[model samples]
Target: MMRGVMNRKVPKEILDLFEKYMDNKVRHLNRKDAIHMLRAEFGLDEEQASTMFDTFDKDKNGQMSIWEFQQFYVCMGTQPSNPHSSAQEVVQKFKDIDADGSGKIDVNEAKEGLKTLKTATGRDLDPKEIEFFIETTADDDGQIDLGAFTNLLYRLKLYNAPPPPKDVKLKNPKKD
Candidate 1:
């Protein structure tokens, strides 16, 4: 059985791996870059990728230097492990829901996504449920990005269910 370590120090091997992706151009891993790396190298899903990025982007500069990346690994090393999804699938889902290309999902877009969910599953999720999801996922800015949304879907187990092969036709629900 593998033992989990709780020390807040990144192992040298991981740091070496991070160095391979570092370059003079950015000299750091931005959120986009982190997403790509986490997907390709770590096989983390959209939510996991985003969580990893946010945890390590210490300065919130939207980017992480190699040093910062190291810190992230250290943090991960100290945390309890949880299951995650394949990065590709999660990333695709996030892209599908982003709708506005703003890198975050606003309330309106989240509502539309809920509609899509209803059409696909034939399950009418309660308005209160949707509001709770929005409230839990949204950041301080009153919007949730792909990462937070991914986490929400993950917790709901919606991320694991097989998605429809094609888009689900949506009917505008008549609001009384």
Candidate 2:
């Protein structure tokens, strides 16, 4: 037997979605998929979808896992879903907004990050919502450090749910 960490079981719904996504040959979800998924499922526009995706995919990996998807969805005022799109674009946008190349977004940088999202969407998200999202997703040290951000993005991109949402969430609130 291969002595490797047992691959975490993926929820069936997520596995189905992954199969569908793979049938489309999308090794990783891209900007278009992200936008389409959001619009079809959440009624968000291209800009809003893009901004949300960029926010979640902090590592720019062009994919997202369930955990990362949940955080991003919550941040965007939406319920998390099975097979949510990738967070790669979000990470790249974060880096671009950092400007100083410091790999961490301070309060001011965080505000600027929101501005970038607003510009992308042509409207400002609620300030409280923005703060809530940042505070919840930021590192324990209260910084949007690069590694933490990237890990979040990677989680979202690589997520593979093997069962239904109800069962999955009920069985494991904090999936490892």
Candidate 3:
């Protein structure tokens, strides 16, 4: 995913229509409706739709307005800032990984945690990559807190980085 600009535009009329769809004067879509809209109208799968919601809902509110979604383009681009942006999931993962409840994970725990993640997500992360990440990011004491762990998967490109800008070429959109 490109950590860059999003220049695509959504018309004001569509925003208005969305507001009307919700039968609320305020320009908003609650979590369920927002996710549904992304899945139905944009044809995003459930995971993609939820990720978009997590990326777009900057305030971490259960609702979003079109403008809010647009503003987040500056932060998230078309791809999310973090794949596991859901608070509950992150917390659960932290608890599962932090074996001693020390609020930190040592290198060994991190390795085990990555294995657990691979089992859960079906994404096989390279062991060498984990070593590299630990070598670089772990504290002098050789431990990382929740914040660092949250960034790990994303900073690692979830083990698959986006193509370089020069190699990227936009394909024409298909018409229905």
Candidate 4:
């Protein structure tokens, strides 16, 4: 059993799609930088990005080599240009978060799922903190449904940081 980092293979088609999307949306960036940029821009923490990257980087080389990236590039590139337009995408995301594909995200699932999100957004959420969140937010059913997941994402977007330009400067103005 491969424990630490799962060796899930990202299909070549998907890899190719990811690369194509990157080329069009982030022409100046290398794959690693692009990944980081996308995560930061989207307000995802390092852990989330790492989990996503790990899924695509079957070989676990730390970087998405051209070959590996190409596989994802193809899949993501062909996806509907309006990522939010597809209900299926939301459903799939919900399913992924469920982990067991159980159609319900329990406390553990929610904790783990939020941890992944924190990672993607470069945020640090301690396990105890996550447990607290789950206790407060989860319903009596002990499950977070797809609707809840969407709401959570929407809330998360509210906290997204503004992007900084390449050359950011701060200057003090003369007091009048």
In TM-score terms, candidate 3 sits at 0.42
In order, what lDDT does every prediction score? 0.59, 0.50, 0.57, 0.52
> Each candidate's TM vs. the true structure?
0.47, 0.35, 0.42, 0.38
Rank all candidate structures by their lDDT, best first, as comma-separated numbers.
1, 3, 4, 2
- Per residue, candidate 1 scores C-alpha lDDT tens digits across 98-171 of 78787778888887776555423456555555665667667777787655654565546443333333445323
lDDT of 3 by residue, 80-142 (tens): 333234433555676698899887889889888876655223566556545556665566788
- As a TM-score, model 2 comes out at 0.35
**Considering lDDT, which of the candidate structures 2 and 4 is the better prediction for this target?**
4
Candidate 4: which stretches are off by over 4 Å?
1-86, 119-122, 160-176
Most lDDT-accurate candidate: 1
Error of 4 at 87 (Å): 3.6
Candidate 1: give the clashing pairs. none
Measured on C-alpha atoms, candidate 3 has an lDDT of 0.57
User: What tens digits encode model 2's per-residue C-alpha lDDT throughout 51-91?
Assistant: 56676666778665444554545443322352233333444
Candidate 3 ranges beyond 4 A from true positions = 1-85, 119-122, 161-176
